[model samples]
Each structure stands twice: as structure tokens, then as C-alpha cells.
Target: MTSFAELVRYLAERFLQAGIESAALDARLLAAYAAGFSPEETVTKRDAALPPEVLDRAVEAARRRFAGEPVSRIVGAREFWGMPFGLSADTLDPRPDTEVLVEATLAWCRKHDLAGAPLRILDLGTGTGCILAGLLSELPNASGVGVDRSEGALRTARQNFARIGLDSRAFFLCGDWGDALADATFDIITCNPPYIETGDIAGLCPEVRDFDPLLALDGGKDGLKAYRDIVPQASRLLRVSGLLIFETGHRQARLVRDMLTELDAGFQTEIFPDLAGIERAVAGVRQSGGDGGRGKKKVGNPIGSG
Candidate 1:
């Protein structure tokens, strides 16, 4: 029988040889999962021999990882905003970088004293509902509706909302952007739309290019297609003083900011960076009735950039 520690080391070596970046961490996670051990238990029982079945499962998981499967996919769940969210083939994997959108939204909510308000949120392209889940979890008085085009993605989002105990506070819709919603219905609209340029999809890391749904990856020729679609819809869906926030691709922040500004939507735009200092999220607050919803400006804030 292979001991848990031995299996972890073996898997780590193979993953390292395969050039997997998080080799050691992935190996341990796979081994722990196979053994049905919690992370803490995995540490405490590292020396214990894994049962034959457990060892077999761990090896199989290792093979899948070697084939470029993400550890989160292998485990069927991922942690985002300190919460575990389920995933599906149709849903884009919830990533830490995308958390920038959530952080910035939260910061804005705090600064505006809306955290405790019964805020209504609409999350576009809400794969796995991670963004909506994160916001709803943090803002206790907030409720949300998540919209996605994929039925499978919507199913996963529904499951995720239930898993996180926010089902009662959340709803899912199958539609194109805000096509299925009423005008000025939400106080906040968030999106992490498909932003990878169509031509650039082939160049993405295999973990993404291979596994994530194509509908959630292809952002058309300029990689700003989704933004173009969502922004116009957001202008109508968001209430006065409402906020529209989005996670942008590499160096795409300025373009996204420009889109919000150029539109006659009375938006006040801001750019925020992620931990790696890449401008990852852009937020725009819709101004009230003045200027007939045409006032626009660009600004910057440091609330959750890091």
C-alpha cells in the first residue's frame, strides 16, 4: 500500500516533470481528495498508508492533471472570495483575478453606504454564479439575478447558489445580457464576460483553452464584444446611481473604461488593479437625472486593487 505521503510525493514529482506550476499543491490536493481527508486531516495523517482504492483514485486524478486538467475541475469545485463554488464544463472557472470585480464592487458599496441596503444586483455571464455568490454573501441585504446563455451554466449557477445558502436570495435567468429584464431594475450590474480575443483563444493556457466553454471565452475580433453588448444593456437595466462593474482582460481596462465613458450613459468610471498590479476590473456608477443620463468621466481608486 502506498502511504499518503509517498503518494503525494510521487504525484508531485510526476506533475513537476510535466511542468505543472502548482505541482506540489495539486498533488497534495488530489491525494487528500482521493483519501477523503480534509486538508487538516491530510496533514495529520500524511504517514498513514492509503487504501488500495484511495491510491488508485489518486493515481487516476494525477493522470488527469498531467493531461492539463485544472485541479479545481478535477475536484469539481473551487474557492473564490473565501467560498467554495461548484463548477461544470459549461461554466468558466472562477479565478482569483476575477475576484477584483467582486472586491471593487464591495468597496464601492462600502464607500457609498449601500452594503446594508436591499440592493438589487444583476450578474451578466454569471458562470458558476461565483461573482453573484460573492457579492450576495458579503452584502447581507443584497439579492441578485444571474443571467447566462447556457442552460448547463445556469444549472451550475443554480446549484452553486443553493450550496452557498443564498438560493433564496438569488435567481437565475437564461437570456442574452439584459434582454429578459425590465429597464432600471437593478442597483448594480456586474459582469466578467468573454474577454479573450477570438484570435488569441488558441494561445491561452491549455487549462483554459481546452476546458472552459467556448461561449465564455470568445470575445469576438477585438475581445471587447461582450463589453459592447453588456454596457448598452446595463445603461438601461441599471437604476440611477447604479453601478456597472466588469472584469477586464490584460491591458483591456482602458478600453473598457473608454466604452463606459463614451456611451451617453451618465457613467462615472474607475479602474482597479488586481494583486499582480494588472488593471483587472473597471467600475462605472450611473449618475442621476442630470444631463439626461449623458454625463461621463474617468477616475481611479485604490480601495481593493491589492
Candidate 2:
């Protein structure tokens, strides 16, 4: 019988040769997953005898890793904002950078005295429903609507809501931005839309560049296409004094800020830094007394439109 220690070493070396950056960690995580143990537990039992089935599953997972599948997809879930979310290819795997948008949104909600109120929220392009689900998990009194263009993605989000026991507090809509949500007015709106420039997609890591959905990536020529559509629509969805929060590429903060300004949306906008200290989130506040200029004029379906 092969020992866990020996299997770890074999998988780690194979992953490294496959060019996975976190080869060792990935090996341990997959091994632990197959053994029904936590990664921490795997460390303590490295010399334990591995069951044949467990060993085979671990090796198969490693082979998938070697082929460049994202570990999140391999394991079928990811942790975001301290919660585990089920994932699928139909959904964009939740990312740590997006947590920056969550933190900023929470801070803004606190500052505006909306933290504990039963405020409505809209999550545009809500892949895996992570943003909306995470926020609802934190704010018990909040309810939300999650919109996505992909039916598969919406199904995944619905599954996540039920898994997290948030189904009663959340609604899933299948349509492009603002179309399925025309009558909704929210106190908080959030999104992490596709912002990678079309040309830059080819240059991303194979894990992301190859495996992730192109509909969740290609941000058009300059990567600001989603911003243009989302900004105006978000403005309309928010109640007066409501907040609009979004995650953008680090270098596109100023450009997004400028776009929000052009909307004349009565928003007081500011940029928030991510863990890397790069400006990764931009938030705008609908002014207390100003009109949102009749909301977004229905533009031809931006995302989730087939």
C-alpha cells in the first residue's frame, strides 16, 4: 500500500513540472480532499496508509491539475469571504480580489446607516452568486436579487443560495442587466463584471486564460465595456442615497471613476484598495436629494444576452 507521504511527493513533483505555481499546496489540498481530511489534517497523517480509491482519485485530480484546470473547479467549490461556495464551469469562480468590493460595500453600508436595515441589493453578473450571497450572509435583514445572462450560471447561483440556506432571502433572475430587474430599487448594488481586455485574455495565466468562461472575461476592446453599461444601469437601480460598488482591474480605477462621473448620477465616488494595495474597487453614492436622471436607458443587452 502506498503511503500518503509518498503520494504527496509524487503529486507535488508532477504539478510543479506541469507549471502550476502553487504545486505543493495544490498537491496537499487534492490529497486531503480525496482522503476526506482537511489540508491541516493531511500534514499530521502524511505517513498514513492511503486507501486505493483515495490514491487513485488524488492522482486523477492531479492529472486534471496538470492539464491546467483551476483547482477550484477541480475541487468543485471555493471559499470566498470565509464561506465555501459550490462552483461550476458555467460560473466564474469567486476570486479574492472581489472580496475587496464586498468590504468596501459593507463599509459604505455602515457609514450610510444601512447596515442593519432591510435594504434591497442587486448583484449584476452574479456568477456563483458569491457577492450577493456573501453580503446576505453578513447582513441578516437584507434581501437581494441576483441577475446573470447564463441559465447554467443562474442554476449554479440558485444551488449556492440553497446550500447556504439563503434561498428565502434571495431571488434569481435570468436576463441581461436591468431588463429582468426593471422595477427593483435597491439600497446597495454590486458587481465584478468582465473587465479583462479582449486582447489581454490570451496573456492571462493558463488556469484563467484557458479554463474560465470567455463570457466572463472578454471586456471588449478596452475592457471598459461592462463599466459603461453597468454604471448607468446601477445608477437607476439604486434608491436615492443608495450605493453602487464594483470591482475593476487595478489600472482601470480612474477610468471607471471618470465614466461614473459622466453619468451625472449624483454619486460621490471613491476608489478602494485591495489587499495588494492596488485600487481595485470603485463605489458611488446616489446623492440624497438628486434625481438619477430617469435611470439607465435600456441599452442593447450587455451581458447574459444570447
Per-residue alpha-carbon lDDT of model 2 for 236-300, expressed as tens digits?
68887787888899599999977765665656678888888899988777765334323444322
Candidate 2 displacement at residue 279 in angstroms: 1.5
lDDT of 2: 0.82
Q: What C-alpha lDDT values do all the predictions have?
A: 0.86, 0.82
Number of the top-ranking candidate, with TM-score as the measure: 1
Candidate number achieving the greatest lDDT relative to the actual structure: 1
Tens digits of per-residue lDDT for model 1 on 44-121?
Answer: 998998779998898789888988899999999899999898889999988899888888898888887888999999
What RMSD value applies to candidate 1? Answer: 2.2
Query: How do all models score by TM-score?
Result: 0.94, 0.90
